[model samples]
Target chain A: MQRIVVLAGGIGGARFLRGLKSAVPDADITVIGNTGDDIHLFGLKVCPDLDTVMYTLGGGIHEEQGWGRSDESFAVKEELAAYGVGPEWFGLGDRDFATHIVRTQMIAAGFPLSAVTEALCRRWQPGVRLLPMSDDRVETHVLIDDPDGEGRKAVHFQEYWVRLRAAAAAHAIVPVGAEQAKPAPGVLEALAEADVILFPPSNPVVSVGTILAVPGIREAVADAGVPVVGLSPIVGDAPVRGMADKVLAAVGVESTAAAVARHYGSGLLDGWLVDTVDAGRVGEVEAAGIRCRAVPLMMTDTEATARMAAEALRLAEEVRG
Target chain B: MQRIVVLAGGIGGARFLRGLKSAVPDADITVIGNTGDDIHLFGLKVCPDLDTVMYTLGGGIHEEQGWGRSDESFAVKEELAAYGVGPEWFGLGDRDFATHIVRTQMIAAGFPLSAVTEALCRRWQPGVRLLPMSDDRVETHVLIDDPDGEGRKAVHFQEYWVRLRAAAAAHAIVPVGAEQAKPAPGVLEALAEADVILFPPSNPVVSVGTILAVPGIREAVADAGVPVVGLSPIVGDAPVRGMADKVLAAVGVESTAAAVARHYGSGLLDGWLVDTVDAGRVGEVEAAGIRCRAVPLMMTDTEATARMAAEALRLAEEVRG
Candidate 1:
């Protein structure tokens, strides 16, 4: 059985994993989810990226919204607002709050993040071993224009993405605490033992980049003798979904398949998948010393996403040869 | 304006307060809510007594249930159970969760319980000043027969009341931190400056009893030189509501209006109100040096309750004379 490891973000990463599971049902998959975007709201631990993966795989993700739980009500959120307690921009449904409350309680009782995730997964049975990027706090703060003054200031990634809607120009993306943080248990082991490591079509800067920012994780992935493949979140000179272009520009990368692939570099990336429309940029990505392919990357449906996953696996086989 | 101080519990105390407020619309009421029954559930501070008073007075209390917010949904509680996390016995609705979340967050940010209660009341605008009996952690633990073995064990007050439904014979009722806790900032002042202090038809052993257990509160009320009056929770040789009879028995007091009045004693209680059904026992209470009255103590409706409150106030005036 192939041991597959994937670095995931929130919505896009979770959706890609569902397709990956459909593509290779027998594969032993381990997900090292980025926790840089984790935020404490109302004194409850909320791991948006982690929960998205769990809910998406567990069949609880809201089908239309792409995040949160299905048939969700905003009773908790509404009441919190009534009490004037909030970051009302980030909607946490009643069912979703249960996850945070449980997680927070376990954490308060002294359980580590990795152990708590495993306990939560017992109920979710997401089929994949979900592990946080690091047990340590690694908040992704973006340097954005200060509204109160002319100077630049740093805001949490969610605040910039959700509250401000990424409207402010981002100057830099910093994964604070990553420098001193150690990768969560099983992260390094999974990477070294993986037959293939895939980077799903997630935010290249804040998602995949934040995971790589963790001290030992980047080194472990690079030194692993497995093929490393990536699916581009960018297509047709723009982000396929969300404001990836805004944060991509912050890290001095253009919103294009070739640029994102080159940003990962040949040393880290063995193969790259770009959307079929970006076929013209295949030569440039290949010329940068990384194997590249143009495929139907749009995850319009589960079947389409599965085919994309199959293509990523085929590219990994080619890279291995 | 009459300066009234009341030590409140949950449903019974909250209902009595509604009548008191109605009876003396211009009175400045300072509620010293019992915090001993407060419990930490799912890592959030749950002050059942304080919230009951707040919700009941602020028009949020569920009228039929007599606690929590009206129009409440148990989505969060249901979800938490689905996640296999809880003491499912305690029913916390989504709307009520907002209050605990706000309170836990504020407490985490270093605000004392009193300050957090004040902040929460700001949103409810509960009309009267609600002060916790103590800012300190004083949990009420009841010694009960352990279901696992023949020996006895201690469980949280909520567990004894809600989970066990007070079915297990209680051996003792201990206010765990009362011996070390100081009265909250305003509690002593409220007692000292009060023209009258009223113990409503709340549980004598755990409600009004817990507030007085706090180190300075009982002493302050005794030294205040003001009229101290009480209405019996017992009626017709049983409790008016709840399992107050069980906890009353734990303290070796018979479940009768006269026994409850004698339990308060003449030094602490100047006047006592027994139900009309217990009119025969008023003479026994009067023999114990407590000025007793047989009024309609059943808080069947707001108007009836107001009349009961009026009777208690009238008795307070007579005691002063």
Candidate 2:
């Protein structure tokens, strides 16, 4: 059985994993979900990326939104607002609140994020081994011009992305606790033993990039001696979804498939998939000593996404050869 | 204005207080709610009696259930059950979860339960000064026959009352932390300045009984030189609502109005009101040196319950004479 490791973010990553699962039902997949997007809301730990993967693969995700519980209701959020407790910008539904409550309870009982994730997965049975990027806290913060003051201020990535709608001017992205954080248990081991490693078309700056920012994780992926492949979240000259373009610029990267590939660079990403619309940039990417291919990168459905996953695996085989 | 202090439990206590508020709309009311029924569920502090009072007085109480919020949905509870996390028998609605989340967050941030209750009450605006019986944890545990083994074991009051529906034979009722606990900031003061202290139709053993167990509280009420009257939870030979009889029997108290008054004794209770059905016991109760009255104790409606509260006040006046 193929051992595939994927570094995932929220919606895009979760949807891709769904496709990957359908593409290779027998493959042993491990998801190193980015915890940079995790936020403490209403005193409960809210791990957006991890939950997106869990809910999406566990058959509990809202199909249209591609995140949160399917039959979600915002009664808890509404009540919290009534109590004047907010970050009301981030909408957490009642079912989603249950996940956080259970997770927070377990963490309070001294379990690490990885163990809590494992316990949660017992109920989810998402079929893939899901692990947070690190058991230690590694919140992603974005610097923005103070909305209320003169100088720039650092805000939680969720505040920047969810609350501000990424409407602020681009500055810099910082993983607040990444320097002291260690990759969660099984993270390094999974990467070291992987037959193929894939980076889903997740936010390069905050999602996949944040996972690699963990000290040991990037080194492990580089030294794993396996074919490393990635799908560009960017198609044409902008992100396929989300405000990825606004954040990509924060890291001085353009919102283009070829530019994102080059940003990861040939040393880390051996093979990169760009949408067919960016086919013209294939040569420019290949010239940088990385194998680049142009394919239909839109994850319109599971079947379409599976075809993309199959293409990436085929590219991984070519890179290995 | 008359300063009225009430020692309260859940449902029954909350309902009676609602009527009391209606009866004396101008009275300065202070409710020292029993914290003995407070339990930590799913790592969140749950104050059943406090919430019951807040909801009931704040117009959020389910009119039919007489507890929990009106228009409550148990999405969070159902999800918790799905995660195999329980006390599933104790239902927490989504809107109700917000209160716990805010409260637990505040407690974690070093606020005492008293302060937390005050903060929660601000939202409810329950039109009374509500205080926890004590700032310290004082969980009520009931000794019961071990269902799986021979002798006996202790279960939380909620487990005994809710999960088991009080079917198990009880040996003793223990307020686990009462020995070292001190009454909350305003509790003694409320008792000290009280014009009248009325014990609503709350459980004798677990509700008002637990409040008096906190050392200084009983002494303060006795020394207040104010009328301390009570409405009997027991009407005839049984409780008006709940399994008060089961718990009443646990403490070796008879499930009779006069017996309940005798259980409280003359020194503490200045007056006791039994339902008209137990009118015959009035003479027996008054013979014990506590003024006794027979009235309709059924909380049939706000009007009916207000009448009961008014009757308790009239008896308080008679005791003063």
Candidate 3:
């Protein structure tokens, strides 16, 4: 089986994987889930990015919401609200609690998150081998004034996005403990042995960048003989989804496809995929010594996303040749 | 100000509290909650009895179901099913996840359950000071063998009742860890300072009995130099709600008002109240050397429950004299 490794963010990455699964049915796909967006909500371990991938691939995700499970109810959410517990804006459903509960329990029982994730995957069966980038806690915190009238504080990523609705300007984005976090077992091996490594159109600074922040993962991918391909999250000078531009600004990066290519550079990139809207920037990205290609990267549906995946694979093969 | 202590179970305890709040607006009401039915489900700490009380008093409880929150949905549960995670019988809603998340987080963070309960109560603000009978983990497990399967194993109180629908014949009931669990903070003090302690018509074997099983609480109530009155859960020869008969049988107690009084006995009982249907059994209960009375114990609504509370108080005064 073709061993394909994909680095992923939350919504788009998950959605793209659904398409990739269809495109390459026999491929041995492995997902290095970004834990940077993981949050401890009401004590439940909520890996938004990870869950998105799990749900999208397992065929349980809400098609419209693109984050939580389909056919979800808010009984548990209301109960928590009645209890006046937590950052309620994130909208955790009753059935979703079971996932968090099981994950948290296994984690508390000294199971590494990767193993716990495997146990969870036994149920989700997303088909792909899903591994958290690291088993250790690596929360993405944004520097912002405390919304509750307190002084400036580092808030969890979900609180900034979900609770405050990402209203404030982020001064800094820190992936806490990423410096110390070793790649989860099988992560380095997966990358090293991968036939091709692909970066989905995830937020570069927060999602993919945070995974790279973990020790050893970036180096392994760079040293691997396989072609490392990255798709631009920036399309037509803006992020396809979420507040990626705002986050990019926090890291002093411009919201442009060319800027995203420069951000990954040769340290991690051999091939870069950009949207057709920014096709003119291909020369600039290629001049930076990374092979660049323009393709229709709009994942409006499964077919579109699968084509994008196939394009990425085709580009990787060209780079290898 | 009246220092009132309430011995409570689930729905009845929470509902009675609404009226108690109305009855004595300025009084200090301390609720001693039953944690016997507490169980770990889907790796989340599910305090069904406590949640029922909290939701009821906090006004988030489903009025129709008499448990869980109203307007609840099951998206999360559906997602979990897709993941193949379960004890599929008991429903955990999305809004409900917040409670478990907060609770599990607190418990994991080294806070004992009483402090966690208090912290959770801070949000719900269920007017009354709510206290779990014990801080230690105490699970109510029922011994039963599947009529269709071989061997006997103790099932968690919830699984045996809610999931299995109480179909199996229960051989015995055990409040696991009751022998080791110390009374939660302020439980004994609350009992000692209480002007009156009234037991709502909750299950005798599982509700108040579980609280009594915790060391120091039962003794404190017995020695508290105040009237201790109880409303009988038995309406005539049967329990008003729940599978109390099954539990009673497990504990080797018959389903009778007289037997219940004897079960509580002289050490813990100062006053006993049976229903109108069991009015003739009051003499038999009083003959056991405890003050006994018969009144309408049916709590069809808040008004009926308040009246019952008043009658219990009246009986408490008689017992005190």
RMSD list, candidates in order: 0.9, 1.2, 3.5
Per-residue lDDT tens digits of candidate 3, residues B40-128? Answer: 87677888888888888878799988898776666666666766767578888766656776798689789988898888778777888
The iRMS of model 3 comes to: 3.1
Rank ordering of all candidates by lDDT, starting from the highest: 1, 2, 3
Candidate 1 per-residue lDDT, tens place, B196-233, comes to 99999999989999999998788888888999999999
Q: Which runs in model 3 stand beyond 4 Å of their true positions?
A: A18-23, A62-65, A94-96, A122-127, A142-155, A158-173, A249-255, B1-3, B12-28, B63-65, B94-97, B109-112, B115-127, B145-152, B164-171
The ten-residue window of minimal lDDT in model 2 chain A covers: A161-170
True contacts kept of each: 0.91, 0.89, 0.83
Clashing pairs in 1: none
Model 2 clash pairs are none
Model 3 lDDT on a 0 to 1 scale:
0.85
- Between candidates 1 and 3, which one is better according to lDDT? 1
Q: Score the docking of each candidate (DockQ).
A: 0.90, 0.89, 0.53
Of the two candidates 1 and 3, the one with more favorable DockQ, higher being better, is 1
Judged by DockQ cut-offs, the docking class of candidate 2 is high
Candidate 1 lDDT over A215-241, as tens digits, reads 988888899999999999998989989
